[model samples]
Target: MKPRFPIPLLVPLLLSVALAADDDFSFDFITHGPMLGEVTDSTVKVWARSQRPGEYAVRYGTDPASLDQVSAPLKTTIEHDNTGWVTLTGLKPETTYHYQVYHDTLPTGPAGGFRTLPNAEEHREPEHNPRGLFNFSFQFGSCANQNPNHGIGPSLPTHATMRRTLPGKALFSIMNGDFIYEEHRTLPVTNWLSQVGLTPGESPEIVKLAPSVVGLWENYKTYLSRGVNLAAWQRNMPTVFTFDDHELVNDIRGAGTTGFRERRAVFRDIGIRAWEDYAGWACPRATSQGIHFGTAKLEEGSDILTDKDADFSKIDLAQAANLHVHWGTDSAGVDDIRLDAESPANPNAGVYDVLEVLDAHRLRVTPAAVADSTGSYSIGRRSHGKFTVSNCDFFLLDCKTHRQMHDPKEPGKKGLTLLGDRQKAWLLEEMEKSGADFFFVVSSVNFMIPHNGAGGHEFAEGKDEAWTSMLDERERLIDAFDALRKPVFILTADLHNSFAIKITDRVWEFASGPLNSVNHVPKNDEGDRPATGLFRSGPRTCDIRWSSYILPDLERLQRLYPYYCVAQINNVFNMPKELGGTRWVAYPNPQVIFQYFDGRTGAFQYAEAIGTERKP
Candidate 1:
């Protein structure tokens, strides 16, 4: 019966368009989004914002009132504040237009839709790079703390139970990190900034923002003028994101290359400019001070973990002594590098001024070759890339940006990385150029053993940010997935206890958490608290299997619709295991239990597949 998402008529249509007051002059709405970013094969990119400004455009085609196609204007001001980001270009692939969003000729909101990406000859058929069928399904989740007390505002009853279970054209959703909780919107949000007029105790202006300014775009414009569940789940699909570490804080750290560049540009330029001004996210070549300006050399000397591919030079610091190199670049398209240090007096000290959050923005140093002298540092940009959908191919790994703070003079470790040597030689050279029989690795962090320094956020050796605080890049990403014996499967969600763990026995490590934040359950160091599969204290919305990849008819992936659960703890013998792998604890008292439901209704809460090695 999953139907309840009127949210009292979507909270007065998103509060009359974020408290509109154009009075009647038209445009005073859609101050947040129309969202739907990065789609190709003829291009698509709409994402709105214009409660005030003027001229903007994105009319769109495929006819809707003979919608004579458009595209030009885009004037929304505030220097990127009145946000617009238009890009309609040609258009065709899997096609499905019918859009809206104007301010000049009038027509403010309503009338939205999008669909692109499906033209490599409609994702190839007729045996083109053939292999089993699996069409598509990405539907990911992550921490969202819109603070409905502590969380769950845009988690929207599981975004209306994933929009009534992936209905009509649904193959795109990957918000792999804290959507908001924007470091408490950087303090001082006094009396709701006086109900939008300011003065109750005033201090707003995002508390004098700037450290690069990403106050969650003012905390998602006050969580979408007070919640409409992430503008009704990003105006009906087409979402792609990444930003662990509470968007900015609560575990924030991504420096190296001698870090401290103005304190790593304060949170890497206001947390990637508040996630590219609230998810318009397009920073690979990002500049205008947001940062991602590449440059890292030293390969012949080898060692940035060796995802080889270097060019930019100039650092001969005493003829590149101590050797041990490897540093790469190619961000706008992805193939980053870093890790393995030494031979640096200032071998470009190895660029720490990058952001968005690791996959190695920049952090270098790696000498070792003569009794290893200090030689260790792994900062980030090792994220490599890949993202097909319907036929399957999701490889985006770079967990824990760039790290520092160590002490391993040979306790089974030296200078390894979670993925930074040009993302482990671009993930074993893109898994020998995968052909996709079904693969996965969209990690942002999480191999298991939860306790990211728990309420203390450690590193000095307390580690725990996922992947055992860097067990030399987690055993070199588990020997590069046990030498890519194929059979790939490892989707992650920052440990809110989304479940399915066990790191070996063939690699399994599924999870989902904070998908919308504030569920904390992590306490250890003697405090103890982690094991709690299928969680949901408040930021409701759960799953690690989520219909084993959000259905789309794989024989209806064991149906479970109408389910809108809210932290339904079934305690499969106190589920959420991995007690010895490191720290994924949680079954402390689970005595006798085994619960699993296929179809849900009584408030819906059943994604019981706990991190997967299977045994629900």
Candidate 2:
């Protein structure tokens, strides 16, 4: 072959072989640092995935060279169809520990490193600061689409700089939904290929882009490929994740029989599956065959006041539904099913069913059912225990599942879609049983207020009635949690901008926007409101005091975009015995810069914290 091979062919062949070999022996590592959650002290979790599966090992120590000191090794198994993950335990709270990972079989692969969180117990007191006062810092933002044109890929330089400057600063990061924009395009082939980047005639990985099922798998693979660096970071750190619209399909509901719903379910299933494959721990254990939905106790009944106290009963059903019917439309006085009042008699009483039906008719329902159906829903569905890493107890609500399709002209017909009897009871139970300091609730959309800015109305046009219904639920939750006097924080993302608001009873709403996205910022300067401190530029930190209230001005910055925010509750150890509490300080202003290609000449524009002026 050496004597007879053509020079051009031989040269190309050699290069191909070299590239393949390099890929085979290479391992990319990402890190997410230690994170603390409700009822739980400080703990760190990390993630990583290999191009090829083999025995993998993670090692750690306080010193880079002495990883042998506290290093623990974990052997990962391929679950949920090839996603890889590892969770470390029994470490000191709040104390930082350096760590690294290596392949047992391949000595030539890359070795990665990261640091763990401080022991929480050691720093229980606000002034019990570390010898030098290590700033507790981390950044979070959502709405990152996989599209290179609008995602983190284009802003690589800014993020890289931030990472370099804040080495070991962030304990963890949360990918609060919309991680991938797979459904924007219409063509299944094109959408699937866009995710992982392979043509139809290419390898099996490429061919696996058809049928919603295969498309999901391909989408996951594609997401991992594009987020190689992110994966590397996650591998070294611990990450908490939740999904948004784009993760499955945009603005999807579960009520209808439309292709969107079916595909959405597939998207959700596969999306979660992909998450498990390439990221951190996802509940609802994965089986060799496929993934399963986790369960929660759901009840059905009337009398909102007594529902929580009602005895439990089980009814077999698929997902969360409305508890009652408040209104119905009559096409000819036949008790139009669409406008029926919220009732336990209806089979589709849960929120999920209502949403499904609404999507089917392109209309919303109102006066939704309220019932108790805990045993029915909990059967087989996945559960995230009582708490998540952010130190808050969470209730993942299926809010829009039950709603009436309002008359396009009668916006007044829309009324509150309260939590059905079952979910309400369950929520109250969780709140009463919660031993954590904070209550964190997750809804797919905003629950408190509506967007009053320009273009905001368009975003919420047909959804106003639904929002009104939500107001009651929001108030109810607040009142319940407020009565407990426990500090609660709401974490939600959907809006493409990062914002925070203080609710009554010391409750705070922290809303993060889509990462790497450019939605129309409400033309109104409402975001500039003085009380709203937007972190535009520079590093900022917040310190929690013992009074159960966050002290303002730890690090204040003005308008900034393309950034992440972290809310930390500190000073519990110094809490006074009478008030029974700790305080939080919103601190350290940090700004993020974004770069995008100008349509005119394909030049990149640099956008950063332009000023300290607050949004009105």
Using lDDT as the measure, the top candidate is 1
lDDT of 1 at 33: 66
Q: 386-428, model 1: which lDDT tens digit per residue? A: 6664434567653434444333233235674544455456656
- Per residue, candidate 2 scores C-alpha lDDT tens digits across 1-616 of 3657788788989999999888655533222211221112334554444433345555656566666633244433323333344555665555566655566532222344445554434433444332221224344456655455444453333234334544565665555666666632222544544433346564243123213334444555555555554444444445556655455455433322211112222233333444444432533221122232222223243222112322222322334233222111111111122322333222323323322222211222232324433211111122122343333455554332332332323323324343344555666787788665456665545444343332333333333322323454556666776687665656666665544544553455565554455442433312222323332111212211101011232221121235445444332223344576543322222122222222213233322121111335
Off by over 4 Å in 2: 1-43, 69-81, 105-114, 120-138, 146-153, 156-158, 161-170, 183-211, 220-224, 227-229, 255-267, 279-425, 442-444, 451-469, 523-560, 572-616
Clashes of 2: 123
Sliding window of 10 residues with minimal summed lDDT for model 2: 326-335
TM-score of 2: 0.56
Query: lDDT of all predictions, in order shown?
Result: 0.46, 0.40
Lowest summed lDDT window (length 10), candidate 1: 328-337
Off by over 4 Å in 1: 1-27, 32-34, 38-58, 62-91, 94-100, 103-115, 120-239, 252-390, 395-435, 438-440, 446-466, 470-484, 487-616
